[model samples]
Target chain A: AQSVTQPDIHITVSEGASLELRCNYSYGATPYLFWYVQSPGQGLQLLLKYFSGDTLVQGIKGFEAEFKRSQSSFNLRKPSVHWSDAAEYFCAVGAGPTGKLIFGQGTTLQVKP
Target chain B: IAGITQAPTSQILAAGRRMTLRCTQDMRHNAMYWYRQDLGLGLRLIHYSNTAGTTGKGEVPDGYSVSRANTDDFPLTLASAVPSQTSVYFCASSVGSSGANVLTFGAGSRLTVL
Candidate 1:
């Protein structure tokens, strides 16, 4: 079965520091990977997606993700973390032809002043 | 706005009661879905509709049901609410049922069954 795994449940980073959130997926074929962010009391927003071509995909709010086919991972990275970047991040893999997504347990990022 | 809208931002219900979570999308997307979010469980798909008049069961669909009478509406119904059904329900839609389509999510409805 197709599935996604986000290793870190919670992560804290100092403002302006570099950040990386790890994600790994298990799928039978070429995977469609995505990263989504959810603010408190709000719906999820798409950050980035990797369907094909270009391993490094950039997204909104200065977020980027690299899809490593060999490792079956698509980890999100940010060069400088901001206070507003504190939110729950989810890694998901698009499954089948229905566009259904299999999401991993989210990683909560907390920015420290 | 041209996005998904979910009704009953939050609701408290007693076990054995019936409840419906309404979802409407003005985007006129071809695919709509319902998912339940829980701590440590991520989000599990409850049900999905590929198009009008067709529905499919998802990862978790034992106690829940759905009907898609039209392209814009997909309401999830709980035949008999249970304590385990307490969750934050999210309704999402995509332009199509292809892997390349990105899903747009609603603000979500927090449901509590006591």
Candidate 2:
């Protein structure tokens, strides 16, 4: 069985400040990781994904995630966050080509002005 | 492009009533899924279909039923709605293999059984 953990239930960051959301996963084989964002009343949107290749992957809205194989972690990062970035972020892991994603509890990001 | 559209944005139903949530995808993807989102549980899969005519159970499929008669539609039905089943339901679909494919999600259907 595979699982994902986003330790922090909530995070607050000042506008223009750097932000990092931690995500850890448990999987036996090489895992496929993804970061998704859901704005108020909106659907989940893919921020970034890592299958295989360079460990560091960049995504939309200046978002990026580093896949540390040894740590079993794929944490999302942003150099600076905007007020509009206030949303819920989810970390998910897929077993294989099935695309069945196991999601983390989620992290609510609040951007303070 | 209209990725996925879920009907009845939100609904409140009485216990023991029957309900079917409709989901459609214009992308013509080969796979579709249904998930329920709670405050702290994130998203749990209820059912999924790899392709047309085939459906499979997911983590939490006890109270739900699904049908995949065609490529574009996958509807989830609750045999007997219960208060515990009240949660925001999401419909998603993917193309080809998921290793590199991103599953596009619908806005979601909020169901509340009273």
Candidate 3:
């Protein structure tokens, strides 16, 4: 079985400040990782995905994640966050092409002004 | 055209009553899935269909049943609604092989069992 863990349940960052959200997964094979953002009262939107390739993958809204194979971590980062970035973020992992996503509990990001 | 549409966007049902959450996708995807989102639990898969005629159970499938009669429709049924079943349900579909495709989701159906 595969599982994902987001260490922080909640995080607060001021506008224009850098941010990083930690994610770790347990999978036997090379994992396919994804980052999804869910705004209030809306369905989740795919931020980025890492199948196989470069260790650093860039996503929308200046978001990017580094896949560290040795550490089993794929952490999302942004140089600076905006007020609109306040939303719940989730890190998901799946094995092979089964495409069945196992999601983390989730991390609520609060962008303080 | 709606990429995916769910009927009765929100509903409140009495416990033990039967309810079906209708899901339709125009994308003609090969796989469809049903997931429930509860507070702090993220989204948990309840059932999935790899094709029109085959269905498989997911992580939480005990209280849910699903049918895929064709490529465009996959409806989830609750045999007996329970308070525990009161959560927002999302229907999603993906193209090609089950494990390799990106899922497109419907807006969602909010169910309340009282």
What digit string (tens of lDDT, one per residue) describes model 3 on residues A21-85? 99999999888889989888777788998989899999999999999999999999999999999
Question: At residue A84, what lDDT does model 1 achieve?
Answer: 98
Q: Can you give the lDDT of residue B33 in candidate 1?
A: 95
Candidate 3 lDDT tens digits, B22-86: 99999988888898988788889899888899898889999899999999999999999999999
Worst 10 residues of 1 chain B by lDDT: B94-103
The residue pairs found clashing in candidate 3 are A97-B99, A98-B99, A99-B99
Query: How should the candidates be ordered by lDDT, best one leading?
Result: 1, 2, 3
Clash count of each predicted structure: 0, 0, 3
Q: Relative to the unseen true structure, what is the C-alpha lDDT of residue B61 in candidate 2, on a scale of 0 to 100? A: 96
Identify the CAPRI category of the predicted complex in candidate 1: high
What is the CA-based DockQ of model 2?
0.72
Candidate 2, clashing residue pairs? none
lDDT of each: 0.95, 0.94, 0.89
Model with the higher DockQ, candidate 1 or 3? 1
lDDT of 2 at A13: 99
- Per-residue lDDT of B1-114 in model 1, one digit per residue for the tens? 699999999999999999999999999899999999999999999999989999999999999999999999999999999999999999999999977789999999999999
> Which of 1 and 3 is ahead in TM-score?
1
| Displacement of the residue A42 alpha carbon in candidate 2, Å | 0.9
* Poorly placed runs, candidate 3 (over 4 Å): none
Top model by TM-score, which number?
1
